[model samples]
Every structure is written in structure tokens, then in C-alpha cells.
Target: GNRAEQKEDLRQLVGLTAGSDDKALLADITLRRASMYLATADYEQAVKQAQQATALVATHDNKTLEARAYRIWGRAQWQQGRANAAKPLLQRALRLATAAKDVLEQAQNYYDLGQIAFLNNQFSEAQQLLHQAIDLFKVEDDKRNMIRCLDNLGSIAILSESNFEAALTYFQDSFRMCQSIHWPYGETYVLYHLGNCYFEIGDFAQSQETLGKTLTLTRLLGDRAAEANALDTLGLAYQFDGQLEQARAKFEEALAIHDSLNDRRGKAYVQTHLGILLSNLEEIEQAGIYLYDALSARSDSGAKETTIDTEAALAWLDMARGDSDFAQERAQEIAAWLQENGTAGVELPFQVFWQCYTVLKLTGAAEEAQSLLQLAYTQLMARTQKIQDEDLRAHYLESVVYHRQIIEAFEATTR
Candidate 1:
């Protein structure tokens, strides 16, 4: 369905219904119009249209219509970043829908509430709400929303805790459902997430294959944003697997696409990746160019990773430039910050410690270096203990370059 075409059609119908004697029908159409407006991100118009629907149903005995109106208004408010204003309206709508026995409306309300909780970082509450919504969606046979719920649940499993196994289950469920519906767009979206997860879980072969499929689908669908994402993530898969040239090519492709789309943030992200990759290749000048550009872009955009990643890359650049003392200082600061505050569900601290360990060992600090490496390895071991899946645990140990490197480093010292 072409959303723009549908919106135009609905607009025409709403025009025809203006001043009609049938108030309930008009209210229904208006509420629907409000939803179309919301879909197009016209929050002001969506709220206005919803208000009209509410006014029409004020003297009418139509709880369902009132619920619909309130839901639209609440969603509009939420989209406008007015969560406080949205919550009460959504609750009121849910109560009305429940009283009217509107199962679908109730599920919609639950889904919205779940989204709110997710955005608030209340993952536990979000999971419970999404589960309740999924139950109702199942009853209604709403497979589209069901897929959406599963994806959100998978994200919660990952973001709240590094429950990669559980996240994989949820995403696989979504992929299957999307396949059943023959929805290529949904399948493409799912594949991107699956690829990232596979990379995180250290299944590089699977990650590359999944991302290859994602690239093919995104090309077929002409989804440039998705295409750029696939390239960037696939580049990371190659980068982590020690294929530096392949990684650089993919990063360059992704950067070009981002430039074409004028996606400043995406450009910054890929530039930073390219900088780090170049640093690993010992191309100090090229790495510096990309790193400083990324630093500026991220700073201007207020991207939080401005300090963490770009600074880390710059430290690597310093190491590649043979400035061991400067590299050690910067690496220590970055590693300390990561150790104290942690990163967003990544083992970044380990990578920092691993890099700095070499500098320490070379600078007559072998004992300290070994101790630092052991501490990082201990942390990695603790995380692996939490993963119940045997195959995933094995993959993390064997396929993850960082994990494998640290283990080898620790063993060599003992030998």
C-alpha cells in the first residue's frame, strides 16, 4: 500500500464527510484521518484531527470511538516528545477500550505503552507490556504487530542484559513470521539485526552471510539507508575477522552512501570505523584525517560516542604513529573510563586493556601488563558464564578475536 496515496484518499473522504448528519461516522473517519496524519509525522495536525473526533463523540454514547480518538491524540503527543502529556490520555483510552470490550484497541494501547517504557529504559516493564500486547495480537491474528513486538522484546533482551541467546530466539521468531507473510521489507530489517547479533556473538561466518543477504535485499528494495547499514556492519565483521582491506572497502562504500544521503551521523560513524581500520593498517596520516573529521562531525551532532570511540581510535592512531608514551596515556584514560562507567553492552574495556597491555609489557611493566590482561580475561570469563548456550559459548571463546587474543596472550606469558 502506498501510504501517501492512502492518505490522499482518506483526506478526500474526510472532506466529503464534512458537516454530515451522521456524527458517529464522521468521528470514526476523523479519528482514522488523525492516525494517517500521525503516520506521516504531522503531530500538530494529528492532534487537531483527534480533538475534532473527541468533540464529535462528546455527547454520543461511543466508547470505542472515544478510545480511538484519545489513542491518536496520545500517540501524537508522545511523538512530539511529550510523554507526560501522552501517558494519561493513553491510560484513559485503554480504560475506555477495556470497558467497551475492544480487544484490538486494548492491544494497541498496550503496544504504545510498551514503546513508551522501552524509550524510558524501563526494559522490564516494557517486556511485560509487550508480552501482554503480543498475547492479544495473537488472539487477533495480528502477525505484523506480533513481529514488531518480538523485535522489541529481542532488543530488550540485548539492551537490558547481554542475553544474546534470548535475543537470537526472538529475532529468529520474527524472521520466520516475516517469511511466512512474504514481506521482503520486514525480512530485510530482521536480517540486519540478526547480522549484528551474530557479529556480537562472534559467529563471523554467519554474520557475513546474513549481512550479504541483507545487502542483496536492500539493493533489491532500493533501501539506501538499509544498504549503508549493511555495508557498515559487514565491514565490522571483516574488520574483526582480521580482513583489514575488505573492511576498508566496505567502510568506504558505506561512507559514500552516507555522503550521498547527507546522513551526517552515518558518515561520522563510518568515518570513525575507517579511521580505526586505517590505524590497524598503520596508515597513520589517513587514519588521522578520518578520525579528526569524525571527531568534529560527532561533536557538532552531539553524538555521545564523540569521546569514547573517536578518542579510542585516536589512541590507536597514536600507537600506529610510534608514539608509545602518548598512546599509553590516552589508552589508560579511555580504558579507565570504560572500566568505571562501562559501555552500552559491549566488551570495549577488554579491547582497550588488550591494546595497552602490549605497551606496558614493552615499557618494563611486564608484571603489570600480565595482571591487566588477566583482569580483562577474568571479566570476559564472567560474562561467558552467564551464557547458557554451549555452541554460542564456544563461538564466543574461539571465534571472537579479542577473546582468543587475550587467552593466547595470557597462555604465552605462562609458557
Candidate 2:
């Protein structure tokens, strides 16, 4: 907590110093402070500083500095949930960098584009962009941003497509690069990502072990946000491993940190996950209340995707309460929203399938239920079929149970 305050103070000092300085120095200081903010995950402040830096460059007329400033500014904007605002700025930066023949700056611009694509859940596009950035980085001998790009690619592979093995391979390569460069923060970042891949693959044991180390390292380094993230991931592993008590503890701790730090999105995420665990324990009313709160929080935080998920949870709760009509209504609402908005990745599809399955089962439409199940299974398998192996195959078993439950329910209804 004390360290967090101290870091904020440093951030303010840097911002003030950069704003008061002349063009060249201001640009340099702003970029440096933007890097600091990125490390601290204070993306809003990073964007502010980057914008300030870009404003200064209009007076100085330095294309290279302007390009770099725009790239960083665009990244910060994307991270701050303004991807549309980021797009044109990043495109301008890329064009400027290319025109200036600044290979490294051009590579960094590509790296930022990859990040934007990843955030928008464009996995294949992100991979292609990141690979291009990596090649550019190698040509320019820029190992640092190259490794960062790799980590981003790894994250997309894990979360967007559930390609855990590919994600792990990327993390391993990133870890090797971080080790070769003796980058402490980079090492922790890679470890955290590796843990996520392991978690997604159902290797809770490895996830727990790696994330435990990451938590310790982040805490020792006084990185509050990173520590909170690691704790949250650890909590998730516990949740999936059926360690409800431990999961609750970890989640409570993480929720406290997010609340204290005023991270609304983080709070919403933990609240939703904690609500799920509570529901699993048959604490339905309490879970419903929490899930509703989580839904509102997610909406306020502009986490529209998570808001949809919490809606699905509410639908599930309604079904569990024997309120089939309400559940069906909510499920239809979600499905309509998903179709209109065209969700970027698999999560939206997953939520849609669950809702459709629930509605079909509740209405005693056995044929439609089986059809939806087949559709979901076919999509999931098609997306991940090539990626699964013996060790990772069990991860898909959850989907199987979901299908089985609907079939069983439909059979019971017919009887």
C-alpha cells in the first residue's frame, strides 16, 4: 500500500516535470514516464502523458519522436478501453515510422497494433501482426519489445483460442529471452502468463506452483497490480480444482486489493468469479445477489463482455430456482445482444450456447436442445481440435458435461 502511494507520487512528479519542460526534453521524459506507467499498469495516466508528448512534437517537428509518442499513446488508449481512439493514431505512427526509415520505431508500432488486435479478440490477426513485429525486431536487434510482443501473442493464444500448448511455447521463448537479458519484471510477466496457460490446460498443479512464485516476486518488487492479478489467477486455479475454501480466501484478498486500488474492472471480475464459487456451494441467493452486483459493476467498468457473462449466470440461477420462463427470457436477450454486437471471440459463443441449451431444456424441446449442443460441440472442437492432446483433453470434458446435463434433463421431461 505504501509502495503504491510512493509510485503514484513518482508518476505525478514525472508528469509535472515533463509538462513543464521544453519540447525535446518533454518528449523524452513523457515517453520514459509512459513506460513506467505501462510497467505499473496505470494505462490511463500513460495515455495522458503520451498525448502530452505528442502535443509537444507539433512544435518541435521531430518525426521520429512524434511517431514514437503516437505509438505509445495509442497503446495506452487501447489499454484504457478506447480501441477506436487508438486505431487512427497507431496507423499514423506506423506511416510516420516507415517514412522516417526508423526500423525499430516501425517494429514498435507493429507491436502496438498487435496489442490492439489482441484486445479486440482478433487472434489470427494479432498473431500475424505480432509475428511481423518479431521479425522486424530481430532485424533491428530489439530484444525487449520483441519479447513483449511474444508475451502478448501468447496471451491471445491462451485466452482467445484456448491454445494452451502454443501459448506455453510462446511463454517459454519469452522466459528464455527475459533470462538472457536479466530482466526481472519480464521474468515475472512470463511466469504469470505461463501459469495462465497451465491453468487453462487443466494443469492446476503447475499453475498453482508457477503463480505462487509470481505472486512472491511481484510482492517483493512492490508491484501491487501484478500481485493482485497473480492472486486472482491463483484463486481461479483453486476454484477449478474444487478447493472452494482456498479459492474464497484468495478471491477475498484479491478483491480487497482491487477495491483499495479503485480498479473497477478488476473488482467486477473477482466478484463474478467469487459469485460462481458461492453458487457452486449452493449459496444461491447470496450468489445471485453477488452476480447482480458483479453485472452492474462490469457494465459500469465498460466490460460489456463480462456483463453478458454475468447475465448468463443470472439466467442459470433463474433456472436453478425453477423460474424457467425468466431464464428463457434472459437467455434470449443475451443471444440477441450477442448476435447484434458480433462478439469477437469464443466467450460470447460459449455464453450463447449455454443460454440456448438452458432455454431449450426448460421448454422441453429435446430436438432443439440436442441441435444446439451439437452446434456448440462442433464449434468448440473445430476451434480446438488440433490443439488438444492426452494431457489437455480433459479440459473439454466440462463441455461434455454441459451437453450431457441438457440431454438428461430433456429425457426426464419426456418421461
- Report the C-alpha lDDT of model 2 over 184-293, residue by residue, as the tens digit: 77888899989877776667888999999999888877766778888888998887777889999999899888876666657666777777677667788988877887
Estimate TM-scores for all models: 0.71, 0.81
> For model 1, how big is the CA root-mean-square deviation?
5.7
Write candidate 1's Cα lDDT for 159-246 as tens digits. Answer: 6777898999989999999999988777887889899889878898899999999999888766676788899999999998988889
- What local distance difference test score does each model get? 0.81, 0.75
Off by over 4 Å in 2: 1-21, 159-162, 260-262, 282-290, 293-307, 320-322, 333-344, 348-365, 394-415
Q: Clash number for model 2?
A: 0
* Residue 263 lDDT in candidate 2: 69
Best lDDT goes to which candidate? 1
Best by TM-score: 2
The per-residue C-alpha lDDT of model 1 at residue 269 equals 75
Clashing pairs in 2: none
Q: What is the lDDT of residue 69 in candidate 2?
A: 87
Q: Candidate 1: which stretches are off by over 4 Å?
A: 1-129, 132-140, 296-307, 345-350, 359-371, 413-415
